[model samples]
Target chain A: AQSVTQLDSQVPVFEEAPVELRCNYSSSVSVYLFWYVQYPNQGLQLLLKYLSGSTLVKGINGFEAEFNKSQTSFHLRKPSVHISDTAEYFCAVRMRSKAAGNKLTFGGGTRVLVKP
Target chain B: GAGVSQSPSNKVTEKGKDVELRCDPISGHTALYWYRQSLGQGLEFLIYFQGNSAPDKSGLPSDRFSAERTGGSVSTLTIQRTQQEDSAVYLCASSLDRGSSGNTIYFGEGSWLTVV
Candidate 1:
């Protein structure tokens, strides 16, 4: 079975400050990783995804994540955040196999609170 | 629709009642998925449908939970005899196909269910 763990339940940061949301996963095989953001009263939007190739994957809103194979971690980072970045962020993992049914296991989510 | 669409953005039902949540995937998406988001459970996969293949129901919590995708486009998640524990956000997502590299899944706003 595969699982995702987000160490921080909430992260607070001021506008123009850098931030990082930690995510770790346990999987028996190679997996695809993703980050999603949900704003207040809105649907989830994809921030980025790591399928293959580069270890550092850049995403929308100037956000990025690095897939560390050794540590089994894919942490999201942003050089600076805005008030509009206040949202709930989720980390997810999917098994990279045809027999795996393409199911996604998600982390507990980290609420990013961007303050002015 | 341009993106995944879910109906009845918010639903309030009493315990022991039956509720149906609907999802409309992207026009050409061949894979659809259902997931539940709750304060206690975060986000969990419930079921998945890909083209005409048998749906993977392994993630369903119990027999009371069921889902169906008609014409490979619209999906409905039915929960019979709902309980307070069933109160959460039911999210739907779709992708072009499963088991492909760099398949990015898009999510709906989700149907918020409240059991009284």
Candidate 2:
């Protein structure tokens, strides 16, 4: 089984300012890391994912995340945020067990408030 | 190509009533998933269907929550005797088969269920 935790419940930042949302996970087996965003009244949209290879992965809307294996962390970052970026962010993990069938374990979410 | 779509975007039901939500996945996708998003629980995996078979239903909170996929296409999630605690956003997603390289899941807008 895998579990994810987003350290912050909410984060407020000025528009155009850099921001980071912290996430950590605990798993017995190797896992995949993902970051997703949810806008008001909308479904979750994949921001980025770290499956293998490079530790740093870039995603849409200038968002990026780094997968740190030893630390068990996958933190999402953005050089500059806009008002449109104010939404809920979730960190998730999926175990490598084929029997799980790609089921995801999600964090409690971090609400991003990009103030103008 | 059309993305995943869900019906009855908002549903309000009285306690002890029954509710049903629908989802249509992208064409040719063989994997479908259901999840629940609530204030306390955040995002949680509910069930998964590949082709016409469901290999995992362990995430379902109880027997009251049930889902079925037919013809390997559309799916319906039914909640019997819905309670106020069942009020949450029910999300549905599908992918072009998971665990393979470049496979990503797409989500629907989700059905908001508010039980009073």
Candidate 3:
């Protein structure tokens, strides 16, 4: 079974400050990673994903994440944040191949609060 | 292009009653998924439907929960004998058929269900 763990439950940062949300996974098989953001009272939107190729993957809203195979982590980062960036973030994983069911396993989300 | 859409944005039901949530995927999307999000909690995978094939129901919490996708476009998730624990925001997502070629999933606004 694939499991994702988000180390922080809440992160508070001032506007324009750099921020990072840490995520780690435990899975024996190859996996695909994703980061999703949910605005207050809104649905989730994809931030970025890491399937293969470059370990450093850039996403929308000036966010990016690095996939560290040795560390088994995919940490999301943004150079600067805005008040609008306040939201809940989730990290998810899915098996890499068709032989395995491509079902997503999500982590307990980390809530980000950006203050002005 | 329109993203995934869900119906009855908010629903309130009594315990022991049955409730159904509907999801309409994006045009041409062949993969649909159902998930649940509780207050201050992470998203929980509920089910997966690919085209017209039998859905992968492994994430469903119990037999009372079931889902079906018709015509490979719209899906309905039914929870029988709804309990207080069943109250949550039910989310729907869809993705293009990539056959493991790295497709991103788009989500709906979700239907908030409250059981009294």
> What docking grade applies to model 1?
medium
Task: Provide the TM-score of chain B versus the true chain B for each model in turn.
Answer: 0.97, 0.94, 0.94
User: Candidate 3 on A1-116: residue-level lDDT in tens?
Assistant: 88999999999999999999999999989999999999999999999999889999999999999999999999999999999999999999988875688678899999999999
List lDDT for all candidates, in order.
Answer: 0.93, 0.90, 0.92
DockQ scores for all predicted structures: 0.71, 0.63, 0.71
lDDT of 2 by residue, B1-116 (tens): 49999989999999999999999999999989999999888998999888756447989999999998988999999999999999999999998875462467789999999999
lDDT of 1 by residue, B1-116 (tens): 69899999999999999999999999999999999988878888999898999999988999999999999899999999999999999999999884483598899999999999
Pairs that collide, model 1: none
> How well is each residue in A56-84 modelled by candidate 2, as lDDT tens digits?
99999999999999999999999999999
Best by lDDT: 1
Model 1 residue B74 CA deviation (Å) reads: 0.9
Candidates in order, interface RMSD in Å: 1.5, 2.1, 1.5
